[model samples]
Each structure stands twice: as structure tokens, then as C-alpha cells.
Target: MTSTSSTFIAGLEVGHFTDPRRPTGCTVVLARQGAVAGVDVRGAAPGTRETDLLAPTNLVERVHGIVLAGGSAWGLEAATGAVRWLEEQGVGMPVGPARLPIVPAAVLFDLLVGDSAIRPDAEAGYRACQAASPATPAEGNVGAGAGAVVGKIFGIARAMKGGIGCASVTVDGVTVAALVACNALGDVIDHDTALPIAGARTLDGLRLLDSRRALLAGEAPRPLIAGTNTTIGVICTDAVVTKIQATRLAQMGHDGLARSINPVHTMSDGDTLFALGTGAAGKAPGMMTLGAMAAEATARAVVRAVRAAHGIDVAGLKLPSLAELGRA
Candidate 1:
């Protein structure tokens, strides 16, 4: 299989189009030839498109692409641009002379972190698709992770900047890769050391605040006014699998989220995960082994998102990156 940095799956092309002006953007995962796919949405306030089509009982056996973007529900429009691009390439389910691309999408609430009036649109999505390639995807403060922030349990004032992250692992002959946009309502932690790496910060911006501890102490701040939060991502592999297995892979992917983020899948979060199989690898691993590997990759991706992030000042409000905070 053709290998891209952090992506070992063949027939998969990853790309992103970022707008630092709005400080938001979109990421596109294109499988022009189509690939088996599945989805799992665990958050109570998710914004997603065409997720039902990925059900094992659905008639569609494969999907053309997946879109992850910022702008909350408004970001969903980005999928249309991806669809249009795929259609132009003659990739999709044939209906007549034209083929309709099956593009599923999900979005995170980054409106509050950037120019709220400016959100990702169809044009942004099309551009992302046009940039698709089997190359190492750019991480941190790009694409859907551009305006992402985490640790909102104490409100946006205490939240830290979040971004995109990716990781991959090879088990037997199968390769599993995960890409994530970290925008959540809680803090991000390092699973290996069980230490808080990023999230809410003290008012002085000198130390990390334990969100869960604060909430338990009845000092939780009111929710932010602008929008809810979410963490959305995709997991791709070269193992052949049925839709049922793919769905299981997505569920396991959530285990990774749980490992890295505190207070995840909250009511204010729209966490969603999608899994795709290219069927390029010679054989598939057992369900248990595949799911376990997916979880590990997902966890690593979440940490990388914050670690790769750089601080930015938006609208006179300075949001610090994990690296900067570590220095302080």
C-alpha cells in the first residue's frame, strides 16, 4: 500500500483548506473508487450528514468521501462542495449519466473561537477536495481544527486552543490511521502518564486547572453563550471488513477519545467518528485486535492535536497553545 505520513491505507487521499482569516477550515478524505464505511456518534449534540447511509442495513455498500469541518452545523454545507468535486471526477453511485457522490460529514463548534460571521462554505469544501493527496496531512491550527478549543467547562475565557492531529499503527498486515479535530468541553490528557497536558487554565494563565475537580467542587462555570463544543474525526484502515466491523471500529475509536479527553461526549459536545476500509491489505485482523488498535491510534491523535497547536490571538482575546502554556 502507498504510505503517507501517518496514513498507510491505499486508495485514500487526505486534504485540507484553511482560512486563517476566519481561523476556520475543512478537511476532506476522498476515496474516489469508494470504500466500505461506518459511523458512530456518541455526543448528545452532534452535527452530521449522511450518517444513516453508513448503517449496515443500508443499501449503499460504500461511500465516496468524508468531510470534517469547523462552523458547527453551518460547516455541513462543506460536504456539498466535496460532492460536486467527486461528481466532476465521475466518482459516485451511478444514477444515469451522472453519478451522485456519497459524502458524509460532521462539524465542530468553532464559531466562538474565530469570526463567527465567517464559517466554512461549499467553496471551502471544494477547495479541500481539490487539495486531496496521499501525503502527510498538516496538523495543528489547520482545516477543521483551525478554530478548535478545549476545556470549556469553565467557559471560553479559560479554554485553550485545540487543533488537528493524526497517528497510525500497523498490526499483522493491517494498518490503522486516525485523524482528529479536537474541540471539546473538557481537558485533554496524556494517557500514558495520566497527566493533564492541556485544557482550562487559571485566570493568570500560569497553570492548568482541573475541570473535573472544579465541577465536582460545585465551582463549574456557566456554559459559553455562542455555541456548544465538539470533537470530530475519521479512522482509516487497509483491512477488508464488513460495515458491521467498520461500525465497531468507529465505536472503538471513541475509546481513544475517552482516554485522552476528560468529561467527553458531554451534552454540549458533538463528538463523532467515522471509519473507512480500503481493502488493500491482504487480510483483516480479528475484531477485538482491530478495535484495540483503533483506540490506541485515536488516543495518540488526540494528544498530537493539542501538542502541535500554536497559540493565536483572535478578536483581542489571546488563546494559548499547549506548548506556550508549558513554558509558562
Candidate 2:
């Protein structure tokens, strides 16, 4: 079940689009008024849009837009469409119509998942804007996750489908939530228990937890090797935070990935996280409090992406969901 946007409901509006043919799409998020934001970078091969602005410590933004798209680096054009729509509505930094609406974005390496030629564009971004709602948002293989894959050690031939996911919890009177698109090179594990949640399943239908082991055992990472690229989208939230704090939050959020994904942020991977605040808090909220909540939520989101996915097959291995395992 999806929840609406409210302080009681994480206070964030969400939207998304999916394409099986392009096998890649996007997820967009918008916050209530007066929300400060930032970002963190931790991927070996990242293709992003509008990250520098999100990292400045002297900036005081209210509520900007967040976009998660497919098309590798080319898909970045999609953001321009979003900015155009936002500028028309006067949503952005305090720079008037000319420079209003500071839209930040991230992209994944889905070039091989779909038509490398059919990249996401301003039209796609416009469509994404039309599709975005300030309420419930779809999850799973829908949106940017449409072309996502996991355990790409063996490359595209061995990876399984991935998608968008979300989770939230209140800590220290502040709601710190997370949403992620997991297309990683390693397995995503349980944050608290350090157990494999979404990684790889063997031919026998058991979890395959180690890629390095598979490689060390003389197993090729993939049937064929591909170029360096694969990205994850992360959004960590709480009460309003400065751009720098938001960036710090994004940095801290990486701790969650470190705990869960083995061989994470590899040279072939482009992992990034964005942090935002809804500006709805009344009392003081420590960064640690928000950081911890963000970490746990991020880990769970990764698991949800896999468990909610379908068509998870590559070569002779199958990555089924908890539903199939009778544990959902």
C-alpha cells in the first residue's frame, strides 16, 4: 500500500515512469515548501546532473526537485524538461524566472538494458512532470528501475532486474525516510542484522552472498564484461537541513550501503545519494538521529526494490523474490 504526502506520511510528494522497451525510466520527488537539501557521491562511474549546486554550504534553498532517470549520461537531458516546467511555476532558488527552480538529478547506467538510441529527453522529463503527484508514488520495476539490474559482476548477461523502493520511520520526533533505485554490483543486505536481503540466488534457489568469492572460485564475473557503469538512487529525508547538512546526510547514508552491499561503489558503479528536509520539525533533531534513520530506511529500500521486481533471470541463475520464497 502507498501512503499520501503529509507530516504523518513522510511529507514528500513522489512520481515515476517506467518503460520495458526502453527498459529504463525515472522517478521524481518534490517536497513541501521551505525544504533544504544536499547530496553525496560514492561511485566509481557516476553519471549525474545538478550535484555541485546541491553541495554548496552557503546556499539556503527552500524546496527543489529530485529526479532519478535512465539513459546513462545522455538521459540527463530529461532534467532540463523538468526545470522548464518548474520555472514556469516559479519553483526554484531565489533567482527570479531566469534562474528559478534549482533541479538536482541522478542517472543510472541502463544503456545496455534498452535501446541505447532511445534515450530519455526533455519530452520524457515533461511527461515525468505530468506524471508526478504530490501523493502516492508507484514502486518496483516501474519508473527508473525499469532497466535496473543487480550482481552485474557477470555483466548484463548475468544481472537481474531492479527498480525503485521506499521506506520511512520517525526518529527523535523527526521523520527520516528513504527511497532508492538499486542497480548495484553487489548484494544488498539487512542493515541491522547484516543478513543477505537482496543479493543473488543460486541454481538451488538459495541466496548467493559473495561476488568476490564467485570470482575467486574461478567463476567469471559475467559471461561477458561490459563498460564501467551502474548507478543507485538514494533520497534521505528529515526536518529542514542546510545544503551542507543535506550533503552530509547523503554521505552518512552511504554507511547503509557499505553495511549491506559487498564490493560496493566499484569502478563499474556510480552510486549517489541526495538528502532533503521537509521543514516540518518543531524541536532540535540531531544529525545522528536523522542519519541512523536514513541508513536503515535506505537498506530496506534496496531490499524492497529486489523483492518487488519481476523477470529476474540471467543465464542459468534465477533471483526470485521473498514472495516466491514464502517469506513475503
Candidate 3:
């Protein structure tokens, strides 16, 4: 599939603050007026914050920001910085004299890919907030995708680089977009062609090894693998939708992940998705249509993440990019 070239949604600003030193970073999606939001965590090992508040029964109807970061659980602190930034800007749920900024966040494990000691913190979140903008944000190796790696079925020794990607589509004047940081323990596949784009490489580094095929062949790796992978993302739409509908949208977003990644949502991966509805354009599409768009956009974004990624050497391990494989 071709890379997403012109995908955008109104009423949202995206930004990133990366620390290449640790090879970890944070990404913030801000809505100054707040947006109705919902989340769906499908992976068995998710690391998140404030997800309970996004439940349909929760009293909070809107959220000010969403944070995606590296550094495993420690990266949740980035959400605090995002909340502080929003509060300083006078945004959030108004109660008495204070506005409690609601920022839901998710983290991916990149510790083994880079400097495990340093992770994204409140300061990183704050910097991402300051860098927020409406223009298309840079993809691959920026923000939460900085240290992302994929296809660890055989272990880190055979893994390839992964990163952030985005895609959007306008249906009947309503825009739906998806931003994804691909850090899965699976191979990325081109949904349309059913071909592997990025994943574990053979020992010769001349061919892609399909993780699913290997697993199905009864090739089981060590048993100590835990919390070593995840893929996180956000789906944004200009359609007016309720919290339940938003939740449904987030659930549908996983269809994209399923289509593009082999062996997804594994026990060791924390795959989480968030949906945000701005309702700023005054025209809302049908729920089915919106959900389909969300899935397609998400799939495209996942492919883009692999396509835009650049190879990197972390510690003594070397990870290759799809481009380096002459597949881009």
C-alpha cells in the first residue's frame, strides 16, 4: 500500500518531543475545547493511565488530551505533564474554581531497544504540548515511535525497526484519521498484497521471516518474554459521536491492526487504541461508514509507520528499516 500523503482532521493538534539520547519520546494530541473520547485496550499487557475515566459510565464527558509515549509504565508520567500544560492553558472539566484536565495515556515498551534507564517524563510531555500544531506531524522515529521495534518472534536479535505512522480520509465532508506507533512482536504486512513489509530478518538479512509462519511451525521461543512489546494509537474523527459510539470506533480501529500485522495482540503486546470525536465540522457520517474509515485509516497508518522508519543501532544490536530491505 502507498503511504498516506494527505490525511487530516479538524480540531486536533499533534506534536512530539523526542530524546534520541535515550531513544524514547512522547506524543500529545490536544483538543483545546476538549473532545468526546473512548478507548479500547485489546492487548494482554497494556500500560495506561486514566482509562477508567473514559468509560461510558464515567462522569467526565470529554478529555483535553491524549498521550502516547515510550519507556513502558514509567512513561505514564508524561500524561501528568500534559495535564499540567492543559491546566496552565485553562482547559478541562470545570468544577468550582479548578479545571481538572483529563488526559488519557498509553505507553509502549522500548526499554530494550535503547537506553533502558531513561524514559519519557513530565518534561517530555510538556515539551510535546508546547510543540503541538495542526499541521501534519512528522512520522517514524519521532515521538512514541522513536525506539519502536517489531518482529521479535525469535528475540531482539532478529527484530527490525518500527515507528509512527498516520493516515486520514474525508467521507462526505467528515474526516477520519489514525496515528499509530508500531511496536509489535509481529511482522508488518501489506494488507492489500498480503506480503510482509517489515519484521524479523533471516540470519543472512536477505529475506523477511514471517512471524506467524514460524509460530505455526511449532517454533516456540523462550518462556521468559514479558512486557517486551506493544502497539498504541489514536483514531480521530470530525463526526459527532457519543461515548459509546466512540468506544465502538476505537474497537474497530483494531481491524486495521489485524489486517496489517501478523500475530498481533499477543500476550506480550499491549495494543491499545483511543478514539476522539471533535464534532467541529457540523456534519457527521453514519457510524458504520465512520467505523470502516477508521479501520482503513488505521491500517494505512500502520503500513506508513514501517515505511517511514529508518534503521538504527541500539547498544550493540542493529535494526534495519524496510527501505534498507529495498521494499519501500
Candidate 4:
């Protein structure tokens, strides 16, 4: 596939951490006009804000901004920063003589990645919002994805690095894109091996365990087998959709997770997907086409997160990548 450079978003900016699993705060501007949006939570362990708007039944209502941050529940505080910044910039709904930016936000667990005490705060959020201005948003371990990881089923000792990933597809002139920060109890498979792209391997790069057998015999460990975990992201499209429709689409988007992960949305995982309408609605991509794009893009995003990450080795425990594992 040919890599497309990028088109910038005016009201959104992202900041990330160098260390994998650290906090990366972000800010999204509602801009002058409110955008249509929806939310979907499919994880067994979820912590979020403005989730009520995801009801799908009322997505048509305009939303000023969406924030995804790292800090577990604490990360959600970044939205306050965004709210304050947007308000200062007059980006939200007008109330009496003042404008109120309705910024909705989400949080993913990264306490396991960085300094649990170090989380995205309202101040960081404001910086992101203040800096955002029609620029290309950063990706890959940036923003809320700084401390994300995948395939922690074996435990943090072997948890692979995680980060933010993005992919976009075009359908009938309309385009839909997905950006995900995958830190789940599940595994993202290589398109070919059917095994985890982030799996531990032998000296020959062979999988150390029989995940297929584990799945069949039910000895296979899951997040419940491991602990609560989650994967979250956003799906954006040019297609015009009601909030509820987009919410349902976000739910349907979980199908991608089902296809790509081993044990998804487990009690320990807080997998979520938000859907937003750019309103550019380049053309009508139709529901099915856009949905398929979202799923495929999600899978790609998962791979990107793991592949872009660097291995972590601390104390006596060392987590290697597929490359280092090949030489084991």
C-alpha cells in the first residue's frame, strides 16, 4: 500500500512520551462548528467520560471536541484543560454571552507503563489545545497511546510495547480513518501467522506456546486469565451519520477487535471506539463500506502500535521484539 503523507486537522494536537506506556495528553477542538460524534465501549474494564453521549440515540447533537489521554482515570482530567482552553478560545456552544466547548474524553490504562503518579493533567491538555492549529497530529506512542501495550496475557514481564496507530481507506470518493491505542489483554496477529505479532518466540522465531491449542482446550489464558485490560480508539468518516448510528457503528467496529485479537474486551480490558463525522463527508461511502474500512483500519492500527514500539528490559526481566526473539 502506498503511504499517504497526511492532511492536517485544525483544532487537534497530540503529545506523547518517549517511554512506552507513559502518558500522552491530547486536545481536540470543536472548531467553529460542532461535529457529529458517537462512542462505543466494548471492554470489560472501562473508565471514560461523556459516555452518555454515545447512546447513539442522540449523536446528531453537535459535540465540540473529543480527547483521548493516558492516565487511566486520571488521564481524563486532561479534558478539563481542553475545556478551559476551548472556552478561552470560544470554541464551544454559546451560552448567554459566552461560548462553551463540549469536549468529551476517554482514558486508557497506562499505569502499568510509566510512572503511575505521572498522568496527563488539565495543564497538559490546555497546552495541546493551545498548540493545535491546522497541523498534522502526531501518531505512534504519542498522546494517550504513549504507554499502551498488547499481549500482556503472559503478564507485564513479557508485555510488548504499545502506541497510537492510524489507517485510512477511501470508498467511492469518501474516506474513513481509524486511530487506535491498543493496550489489551489480547494479541494482534500478523496477517499471515495467525499468531500474535507480538508473541514471544523461540530461537527460530517459532511461537513458544500453542495459542490455538490453548483456545481449543480452554487452557489458554485470557485477560481474565491475566487481568483486566483494554484497547480503545476512534473511527472517523466523511459520511454523515446520526450519533446513535455512529455509536452503533462503534459497537460494530468491535467486530474488528474480534477478528484481530485473541481474548478481547475481557473483564480486565476496557476496549472502546469512538466514531466522529468530519462532516467533510467527501462523498457517500455508505454504511457497510465505511464499517469495513473502520475494522480493517483498526487491525492495521493494532499492528502499527506494536511494531513501532521498542522492547523494554528492566531488572532481570527483559521483553524482546519479534526481531530480538528471532536471534534468541
Q: Whole-model Cα lDDT per candidate?
A: 0.89, 0.68, 0.90, 0.65
lDDT string, candidate 2, 11-99, tens digits: 55666766545567877776535467778889867888867766565455555577888887887887888778777766666664364
How far off is residue 241 in model 3, in Å?
Answer: 0.7
> By the lDDT metric, which is better: model 3 or model 4?
3
Q: Candidate 3's error at 24, in angstroms? A: 0.8
Where does the lowest 10-residue lDDT sum fall in candidate 4? Answer: 8-17
**Per-residue lDDT tens digits of candidate 1, residues 1-328?**
3123544468999989998577899999999989999999999899999999999899888999999999989999999999999999999999987799999999999888657888999999999999999876889999999999988888787789999998887876788899999998889989898788999988777789987787788885774643489999999988988999999999999999999999899888889999999899968878888898889889999999999999988887678899888565
Query: How many clashing pairs in candidate 4?
Result: 18
The C-alpha stretches of model 3 lying farther than 4 A from their native spots are 1-7, 222-224, 326-328
Q: Write the per-residue lDDT of candidate 4 for residues 112-152, one digit (tens) a residue.
A: 65457778888878776666654434665566666676666
For model 4, state the Cα shift of residue 135 in Å. 5.1
Comparison by TM-score, 2 against 4, better one: 2
Candidate 1 residue pairs that clash: none
lDDT, model 3 = 0.90
Which ranges of candidate 2 are over 4 A from the true structure?
Answer: 1-11, 32-34, 58-63, 96-99, 200-209, 216-220, 223-229, 312-328
The 10 consecutive residues of candidate 1 with the worst lDDT sum are: 1-10
RMSD for all candidates, in order, please.
2.0, 3.8, 2.0, 3.5
Candidate order, lDDT descending: 3, 1, 2, 4
Which consecutive 10 residues in model 2 have the weakest lDDT in total?
1-10
Clashes per candidate (backbone, < 3 Å): 0, 7, 0, 18
